[model samples]
Target: MPVLLLALIVFLSDQISKLLVRQWLQPNQSVPVLNNIFHLTYINNPGAAFGIFAYQTPLFIILTLAVIGIIIIAYKQFPIHNRLNLKLALALQLGGALGNLLDRIRFGYVVDFLDFRVWPVFNLADVAIVLGVGLIIWELWRKEEKGEAQ
Candidate 1:
């Protein structure tokens, strides 16, 4: 129940943020919240992260569907014990992937806005995906260390 709720929240937040950005900013127009540090710059990305493999909409859609399917299978296989963080991490990834998938289906691209001076411009969905992956890696490392110490 909690996992579903969290996933729903992430999905809704990502979609809403992207919609608002689309309405407020023109493509390639940027509004800086923190001068020279962060900005909201709208873009339609037709490829993977950092704009690599640009203009491959169909490939991205297929890949996103595959990833979502794998996440669902993995989530179902997780032991029903004290792994709330693991569940939440999967939820985040699932939600984020779905959000981007919808964009690809509807627009042939993903809507990205949040921008930092250094990294590639990305959206809320991308943020959730990265954070989810990071959490999973950290949890696995922690588990391995505990097992080693015992």
Candidate 2:
């Protein structure tokens, strides 16, 4: 249930924000929300993060599918007795990946809007992916400190 909720929230948030950005901002239009720090800049990414693999749609599609499969298999390995964080992290990744994957399939690109000057421009799906990774790392560190890693 928690996993499902996490996935749903991420999917809904990502899609809604992308839709809003598409409606309000034209391609290459940027509106600063914070002085030199944060902005909303419309961009369509035809490839993976940092714009890698541009024009490699087929390769990205295949890789996304493979990642989805791996996430599922990895999630299944999570201990049933563990905290909900692991499930939530996996769910977040599942939702974010699917969100971008859907765009790649439908538009041949991923809609990205959120922009931070210090970091790469990203969207809600990117947030989910980063947060999910952070949670997983935190869990690993916690387990290691407790000598409970197995």
Candidate 3:
């Protein structure tokens, strides 16, 4: 899928979910989805994922914008016409970036709600970003391995 389309979907879905959480739950409230395993917890994160770099909204905002710009430029210029996987990975990264960026711009924080008791709370954007980056890394590693074998 086109990176922009994926980005729009992630951004809208993240924003809508955050809105729903804000409407139906108070900050710090927890609703168990899978007792002891998962919970829908509403929390405002003023920093990067999992509360790291807490309260650095401005820095995160600028960094996200720069990342988005780089993604767009790189995608258009790269010769990956047959590499659907890479394109999808890039799209996912863009989507996740835009999702969190929107949150930072609108509320000065990213709304996080997914809670796995032992882990820091996070949202879909975090999931997408992690998966996208992992995929990209894996792809690059595979390419290097193939080149070395050749």
Candidate 4:
């Protein structure tokens, strides 16, 4: 129940932010929030990260679906005890995947707007996905270190 709630929050946030950006900015338009440091730059990404494999909508859709399925299966298989972080990570990944997948299905591309001027433009879903992966790695490393100490 908690996982579903968290995922729903992420999905809603991602979609709302994208919708706002779409309404406020035109494609390739950018509004700097910080001097040359950060901006809201709208972009329609038709491919994976960094816009690689552009126009490969079908492939990305399939891959996202596969990832969503794997996350669901993995989350269910995780033991109920002491697996809060793992479960949270999976929930985040699931939400982010669904958010982007919906965009891909609706428009042949995913909507991105947040820009740091150092990395490619991305959206809330991407942030959630990256944070989720980071949390998973941190949790696994902590467990490994604890095992070694014991």
Who wins the lDDT comparison?
4
List candidate 2 segments past 4 Å from native.
none
Q: Which ten residues in a row have the lowest lDDT in candidate 2?
A: 77-86
Q: Could you give candidate 1's per-residue lDDT for residues 1-150 as a string of tens digits?
A: 887788889999999999999888899999999999999999999889999998899999989999999888888876635777788898899889999999999999999998897999999999899989998988889889889442
lDDT by candidate, in order shown: 0.89, 0.87, 0.85, 0.92
Candidate 2: the clashing residue pairs are: none
Clashing pairs in 1: none
Put down candidate 2 lDDT per residue, 82-122, tens digits, no spaces: 67677877888989988998889888999999899887678
RMSD (Å) of each candidate, 1 decimal: 1.8, 1.2, 2.0, 1.8
Where's the lowest-lDDT run of ten residues in candidate 3? 1-10
In model 1, where do residues sit more than 4 Å from their true spots? Answer: 148-150
Which scores better on lDDT, 2 or 3? Answer: 2
lDDT, model 3: 0.85
What does candidate 1 score on TM? Answer: 0.95
Q: How close is candidate 4 to the true structure, as a TM-score?
A: 0.96
Residue 36 lDDT, candidate 2, scale 0-100: 94
How should the candidates be ordered by lDDT, best one leading?
A: 4, 1, 2, 3
Error at 46, model 1, angstroms? 0.9
